[model samples]
Target: MNADTPMIDTTAMQRIGGQLGTNPAGIFQDGNGRRYYVKTLESPAHARNELIAAKLYQLAGAPTLTYINTKAPEQIATEWVELDKKCIAHLSESERKQAQQWFAVHAWTANWDAAGFNGDNQGVVNGKVLTLDVGGALAFRAQGDPKGKAFGIRVDELDVLRSDDGNPHAIKLFADMNADDIKQAIMVVVQIPDEKMRRVIIDNGGSHALAEKMIARKADMAGR
Candidate 1:
């Protein structure tokens, strides 16, 4: 990671690393010597969901992941998801480990959801963890309103990118109904760790806070 950018704290890393248990996602190194992968603790379905979301963004010429959903034995079918140069996947063991730490810290602090839609940036050029992607903000869970309960889906805008300094920026493209629900959805997206990511989403669409009562709903079996 960069000198200016924050590095994972040793104590915090030791805590989360123990929780990660195994490294199901194989390792690879990025150009900058960083490594990354979806957490092994995450189910294959969840990993595939993010990969699919990344692929959709790729199809739209947006910056996202070139994710493959298959196992090592089925590597031959690895799809060619041509995303914007900014969205290309950077798989590396070091990057993945660092990312896992970041995700764990953010989850503990944010406490929004278990995963909190966290993703890591592996585009570091030096020793710094590059901000290649904006994380946080989920599709639907609860409207911010103290009294309202609703849900929706979201898509990212094109402006989100990996900065020269390696900060992940974002632009949220929301999709769903329920005014309060949408507002809550907006909150999660805006809560993204990097201010640039929040700004990107606001610039692309807009921002708002929930006015109704907050209500949590059970996610469908399909998963959020």
Candidate 2:
């Protein structure tokens, strides 16, 4: 569903999975039997941040869980799609082929945690690669884009690839992808207008101030 959809109440969502993280977050099944990983964000702004990131992922056509608009401002939910236990580095070469879009999406959002030595946020499902968690993305990188170089990738004294900013080791997964596809993914976000972004925030229980922040962040990414 789009961001303009109404927020759903958690009252009817039955707990299905075990409690996770330090918080009381859980996997819940809605009345329709759709499961979602629901968690209370650190703050309302963070909730909006996650929402924006989810939308960006959706816009890029990244294979990811669907972000839900919970009625609680500090809470968020993502529709769960079962994936194999393999982590980022363990993905087979074939599964990695379509990973470029999400990688570019991560860079534009400054999701350093998705890369680096920590890569559990992603895995494979039926041979298709997808990222699972991106709660910490969307910090926004304004300096370098269009060329999309904010991190370096090197091998045998040769620079092979560069991202907006991720660990050289972790982000190299994107190196073998079609550059045009990655650029197109980044452009999907860059093309969103301010009014639409504001509507997205307001429709999702985010404050006007939060919408303003997202607008500024979007402008920064676009201006670059």
Candidate 3:
């Protein structure tokens, strides 16, 4: 866990809803009375992916939810926000820049579930856009994994090399991202300590090979 990652007491949590999608997630109130969206995965690898991605986004200066690692394995609590849809035209220049930087960083992490792209996994807080879910990142399939055949699944190299499409807002935001902006985003990944990264990989059943591949992908994005 990152030194800054919050630790939540699961014993005080109160579930607020049914399962979300295939993952068992619920809206809950913590001991302090703060509400959060908690998601629990069956795979340790997936939980680790979500936590690391959230931390990377924070380092990259992107708008993201506060991610906390609960006592239970495969579970995490994210700061809650009201879901809303506001067109790009409604965003101010600063918000637009933040959104673009977020897209660049998301691309660096090979995250395909970003909101306003292919999924409704985003929410607005104080008129700024924040990513609500980042669990679908850094995925590596072993031989014979069925997800490998899924259409539109983004791999590390492909995400680094691909251009934004389908979402007009994302396309416009990315258009404003210069090479330097991309390099800064990639540098965030480079700044993460190796020991912390290794723990995340090993504890989550992820291979060192995948971690190295992701680092290389960040390098490729920086060069692009």
Candidate 4:
């Protein structure tokens, strides 16, 4: 991020080494005194993929750490949500529904890295389950997973590469979602206009090819 980025404060920061990954990351405060987690990435695709995932989560209106677009492609930042260490196994009916919403959006985003309920990103904020750290989502792939299937269900089959180590509880939550609910999440993702998507992608140092691929996938899902 440049010095001119007025909203973010780079002066007051806390290193989060060994907690998030090998990336050089820390939590920084914003002008409004809210803390946000920012990772200084070396790959543009890695950064873009995570930012896209953040936008996807925001579009779904699921309980997730809010992603803020950075001026540099090597930086991915999100509003740090203060959450308890408790996992999502135990929750009330309403909270469970919110967790299910997160599951649907997670699958919709094809998150290959962060495991929603099973992994370390699992936390409870205000009795709501939220997941963070999406650097391996979107365009990233898991072993043995076929390419050209980044989004949507194809021919009644869906890949399981969305999670690194999906747990039984997480699997059950995703399976419990009716088709309609999943569709609602996808609908939210496809609602972003093509021009806006292009701008967001290009502004963040993503290639036009990536933007076109995302739009084509969105168009395919919309047509179906």
Can you give the TM-score per candidate against the true fold? 0.27, 0.64, 0.68, 0.67
Clashing pairs in 4: none
Off by over 4 Å in 1: 1-38, 72-224
Q: Write the per-residue lDDT of candidate 1 for residues 101-194, one digit (tens) a residue.
A: 3321222112122121222233344433332322222322211211112122212111111111222221111121234533443344333334
lDDT of 3 by residue, 1-224 (tens): 45566777656787666655446778888667787778777666567667776665665566777776687777867776665644555566776666655665667665655544433455567777877666755552211122343322233423432354654444555556676776665565556665665565555556677566556655565465
For model 2, how many clashes? Answer: 2
Candidate 4 — which residues are off by over 4 angstroms? 1-36, 40-44, 68-73, 102-104, 141-169
* Model 2 accuracy (lDDT, Cα): 0.60
Candidate No. with top TM-score: 3
The Cα RMSD in angstroms, rounded to one decimal, for candidate 2 relative to the true structure is: 7.3
Residue 27 shift from truth in candidate 1, angstroms: 1.6
- State the local distance difference test value for candidate 3: 0.60
Question: For all candidates, what are the clash counts?
Answer: 26, 2, 0, 0
Question: Model 4, range 111-193, lDDT digits (tens) per residue?
Answer: 64435435455567776677756655566642223346544343121225222234454554455566786677567656777
When 3 and 4 are scored with TM-score, the better candidate is: 3
The regions of model 2 sitting more than 4 angstroms off are: 3-6, 19-24, 140-169, 175-224
All-Cα superposition RMSD per candidate: 17.2, 7.3, 5.1, 4.9
Error of 3 at 122 (Å): 3.8
